[model samples]
Target: MLTHPMPDPIAFQIGPLAVHWYGLMYMLAFILFLVVGRIRLKQAHIAAAGWRYADLEDMLFYGVLGVVLGGRLGEVLFYHPMYYAHNPLEIFAVWKGGMSFHGGFLGVLLALFLWSKKAKRNVLDVYDLIAPLVPLGYACGRIGNFINAELWGRVADPSLPWAMIWPNVDQLPRHPSPIYQALVDGVLAFILLWIYARKARPRLAVGAMYVLMYGCARFFTEYFREPDWVVNVLGWDISAGQVLSIPMILFGIGALYFSYKFDKKAAPTNVAKPKQKHAQ
Candidate 1:
């Protein structure tokens, strides 16, 4: 079994100010959004929809707010509400570390809804446009988690090749779950979404696909990672991540059904039909 490198959290210091890898990772996530968003804007369907760089920039602005606020609140309310409630001031202590993906997901949806209203665009359209751009950025955040060695995985079989031992945790070989998530939830999701989004489908289809992909991916990965908290649902025990994902999975299925059942406008195609007629 291999041992975790346990890299220092701080990336560098500029005079009096110190920068953390975690913060840099967040910055990278935003940058990836812009970079990938630009490429997404070039798609025929997206461009025909009149999305411009200006709109993309504005969406990024709103998305950052959603991610920060939603992630923090999710962590507070979902994970440690009682502690935060007892020490309310600690709620503002974001630098101490606590954020939730599901919370950020909801926050971004709200932010995008507001942006959609301002841009006079359909919220589902906005969601579809943005869905393909998110997973790589998510991978970056998981890398940040790995660097901090904060969310180590459960114990693994000694025979597992890549099984890692987080020195800070214990000597037992453990699945390096962050890397697993980065690969599966982040990279894999991005690949599939990017390919799927390359073609037009019914309205809300892409967005629903993203929700389903993330929910399933998160559920699968949770098995490797240690549970943050467990909830007893009926008689079965489930992790908080799984608990959160259950709704997303259901919503995805429902939305996909709705998209295919009612929204018959979009049919899968690689390119938009040419406006000009050619001589036959």
Candidate 2:
């Protein structure tokens, strides 16, 4: 059994302003988005599609707004609507900490939609381009969660290797679920999605793959983590996260079917063909 390090949340301070590791993690996530987006743009198909650094920058700006606003609102509304209703002013105190990935996901979709409209690009195309870049950023957020020691996992067997005890919670050994999520949901998902997106598939396939991968990953990880809330679905108990993921899974499957079945024109192309040298 291991004990959580419980590092200080504040990384450093400038004058009266104390900077939190969570904030730094977010900054790192954004930086990674730009860095990875640049690499993604270098792919022949992406370059041929007219994506530029300007568009990536613009999208990041809008995405930031969506993530902050949507994640906060989701935390308040989904988890503690009544509490927030009673203490409305506290909602603005995001520094105190609260966020939701599902809400952020929705927010990003809306932000990307607006960007697509402005850029005169199909929404699915935008989604495909951005999907592969998200998981690593998500992994960063989970690391932030671990650093803050907010979302501790459920109790685990004492014999389990790497089982951790969050002194703040209890003495019982628990799964280090945030790390599990960072590695599985964030890192592993990114790997799979990045590989799949390397070559073009049907128009919506790449985005759908992300939805499916994340939905499955989140559903799996939720089992290890403590439940935020439980919902009774047709006499079966399930976590709120699992409930939310179900729809994403269904959407992914449905969209994948539609992409391959109906949208045949959107199939993979040889747009990424390598340039050949002329006979010497």
State TM-scores per candidate.
0.91, 0.92
Worst 10 residues of 2 by lDDT: 262-271
Give one digit per residue, the lDDT tens place, for model 1 in 172-268: 9999999999999999999999999997788999999999999999999999998889988799879988999999999999999999988966544
Candidate 2 per-residue lDDT over residues 1-280, each given as its tens digit: 8999999988999999999999888889999999999999998888988999988899999999998899889988877899999999999877556778988999999999999999899999999899999999999988999998878898999999999999889999999999999999999999999998987678889999999999999999999998889998799888978988999999999999899887865745566988999998
Scored by Cα lDDT, where does model 1 land?
A: 0.91
lDDT of 2: 0.90
Off by over 4 Å in 2: 266-280
Per-residue error at 276 for model 2, in Å? 35
Instruction: Give me the runs in candidate 1 sitting further than 4 Å from their true place.
Output: 86-89, 233-235, 266-280
> Which candidate achieves the best TM-score against the true structure?
2
